[model samples]
Target: MVKIRLKKFGAAKRPCYRIVVQDSRKPRDGTTIEEIGTYQPVTQEGENQFTVNEERAKYWISVGAQPTETVKKLFSKKNLNKK
Candidate 1:
């Protein structure tokens, strides 16, 4: 099974995340098939805080890649325009 989920990265106090597609059984921060976006919760709340390739994301989902709850919410919040 494959899933779309977050991979953590960044400094000790400043956390960032990559939205990735990977095998469901793999480790959370393990290698992924592809990276579809990024999330920076510490940054100002707006389109600049995240960058998602919505087209790629939809393609993965259609093929049965399930996204985590948090990633799902992020997708919904992002308008995917103006960038």
Candidate 2:
């Protein structure tokens, strides 16, 4: 199955994540099918904490891509799961 999930990145104490599309069998940081956006929780409040390509996200979802729990919450915040 294909899934939308976060791929960990960044330094030891400072972590960021790329929201990517990958096969469910792949490792967490393994090859990704597509990178749809990013999330940097450590970034300051005023900065852009995360971003998502709405078109691609919708396309993936339409094609039956499932988002992980965390990713689902993020999408909900942006109203991306209303479809």
The candidate scoring highest on TM-score is 2
Question: Candidate 2, overall lDDT?
Answer: 0.95
1-83 per-residue lDDT for model 2 (tens digits): 99999999999989999999999999999999999999999987699988999999999999999999999999998888855
Best by lDDT: 2
Question: Local error of candidate 2 at 71, Å?
Answer: 0.2
lDDT of 2 at 40: 94
Candidate 1 lDDT score at position 25:
94
Superposition error at 52 for model 1 (Å): 0.4
- Candidate 1 lDDT over 1-83, as tens digits, reads 99889999999888999999999999999889999999888876554778889899888887888888888788778642222
CA lDDT scores, all candidates in order: 0.85, 0.95
Q: What is the TM-score of each candidate against the true structure?
A: 0.86, 0.96
> Which RMSD does model 2 reach against the true structure?
0.8
